[model samples]
Target: MAHRPDTLEHAPLGRDSAYPEQYDAGLLYPIPRAANRAPLGIDDDKLPFVGEDEWHAFEVSWLNGRGKPIVAVARFRLPANSPNLIESKSWKLYLNSLNQTRFASREDVQRTLLRDLAAAAGGSVSVELLGVDDSELVPQRLPGECLDDLDIDVSDYTPSAAHLAVGEVIVEETLYSHLLKSNCPVTGQPDWGSVLIRYKGPKIDREGLLRYLIGYRQHQDFHEHCVEHIFTDLMQLAKPEELLVLARYVRRGGLDISPWRATPGLTPPSPLRLARQ
Candidate 1:
């Protein structure tokens, strides 16, 4: 189905919802990416960057072949060009449906999730189930300089490109800040996160960049869209030759969303959880 801004009103967000007693793929809501991309001058067929929406479900559980409870964490990688983005709350509900359902094995659960999520996202999605002790799931800090120590005054809390400025010095560096905060457009609840920005081109004014990130404190949007907005804004304002923007948001409803968009050939950084996640 095509996405419209108003379609979110029908999704299982903002309103109280019932938990499903059985596995129901229909509970997953797909919001087409075009609806939000249109405002940013992005075409679904001609995306500027390649990346993925890495989702970690921390409260995943299901019954085994013998009806014994099993618990594991799940990581889902959704392509950036996917036709649709699954609404977070609906994703949580869909996972909850599996709590009482029985699976033959972890492989079976992973296969089922891959099939359902790929279909919902309208693109190939990778699903991996990890045991609680998986070493790869360890928390790590975002690699780069932290900008939160900047003693700068700020008043604007709205998203704006005006705060972004670039210097003539060509450089490649990674910078990050933990001050990223935005609101959910549907529920008005806050979404807090850390953001990493890596680029190669004219030097981006650090103070201006920090101000630009802090500007999202009062803005409202989804995680994926916010990252895309930042990517596009920097591409236009700073004219970076190469750029990557990733945000690791704190988990809500037992799930965390980390979306990254990068230059066509640049590899995405590891999807490690931050301390706050």
Candidate 2:
């Protein structure tokens, strides 16, 4: 979906706010997903794929009942059908509020987060708080074939599905690229990420897919929107019988957002933190 020029004006992004040191759920901002989905011809009832957004908060902290500081990592998984998404800047501000607040226990903190975030998202959001020492917090690489070594001329910056091609042969494969880059809708700041494409259908032309992915270099949109665009493009162009599109973006403001879309019957992949994240 193309960037909505007016949405940024209503959001707290590219602006300042009174950061609360106390736990205040009002600090969270929710942007309606329909605003962006409408442009892509994607409505709530006509979703093309099923998936979830896995978000990692690396700098989570709070004061204990005894006035001792405690730190942990947070993972939030929001379903793709959620009516809204929490703004990154607002989420960061909300998390910072917990820093000076005192909680009786980690369970209390988790309950608060689950309630506040789910209210903001307009849906049920799964929350997980892991200790800093938890081995599950280990960083892992995406499993796929890297396609960054292609030597091709890339001059076009606008997205074009014409760049996608499917050969006469049929095969199942997974392809990925670490060169995915896009600009933030509000700040125009660069967002670097990697993309993974897996499907069971006609073999996609590697060069064409790479070019299509790179065409977003100058595009300005949220990480989730870009993944939806890629999914819709491939479904229309390549017509893959079974398809999955996942984007892993680097952290910005101590938070990273990863979105994945797949066919109805297929389960989504587990979350992983790449070295860049």
Candidate 3:
């Protein structure tokens, strides 16, 4: 098991806490990204990939000037270069605080959230607030070649970069699996997710890749960090000319995090919620 870094030592992840009915930005906690990236050979100054961490807040509510409650869903986009990553539990608490606050307009609420989230993320954060009636709420299946149907025997459950054996011919392929599971660095709670990998380079052995992804079953890390780790490992071991890695985790506390990392020039995939999310 990996040791929890000092940055997460003070987070409210595993701790019991009171929910604030009043608006309070103090509820937000930002953990430095360096702490987790260090082990993966990721340096903020010279990042090998460009991506964003997409977060969906399903239970957002606020009071209007008329004292009537307004409800909506929100999407937050935090750049990968952000110096800090907001802790999910604290993010939930912060959103809960807005339940009783009155906003002059929806734009006002969005601006406030954008500013606060950007500050917490240590980078510019984009926020989109939408009504529940929006058609985007529909769930969609992940796009790629499903690897879950591969009938293979598994023995090891720990992460291993060696599993990504390469073939002689270069190819372009997108592979996905719903078996990606890791634990919380602080609480040891299971974090279940599905991962998609698209690359244009030497072919990666399918069975080996599946085994490699499932290897994270006992690994402990955040969603964003885990995605980066996968990206870094593939770039180093598989030696792909182009690669993109994205992982979508199930909703826990009305929020689901999807982190993606891709080489320059590749457009990001659509931010669609999976069936399980």
Candidate lDDT values, in order: 0.92, 0.87, 0.89
User: 152 in model 3: Cα distance from truth in Å?
Assistant: 1.2
Cα lDDT tens digits for candidate 2, 90-168: 8898898999999999999999999999988889999999887778767787777888898988888879988888888
Q: Candidate 1 regions off by >4 Å?
A: 1-6
Best model number under lDDT: 1
RMSD of each: 1.7, 3.2, 3.3
Instruction: Candidate 1: give the clashing pairs.
Output: none
Per-residue alpha-carbon lDDT of model 1 for 137-169, expressed as tens digits? 889988989999999999999989999988889
Q: How would you order the candidates by lDDT, starting with the best?
A: 1, 3, 2
Among these predictions, the greatest TM-score belongs to 1
Report the lDDT tens digits of candidate 3 across residue range 136-230.
87888887799999999988888998787888999999899999999988898999999999999999999999999999999988999899999
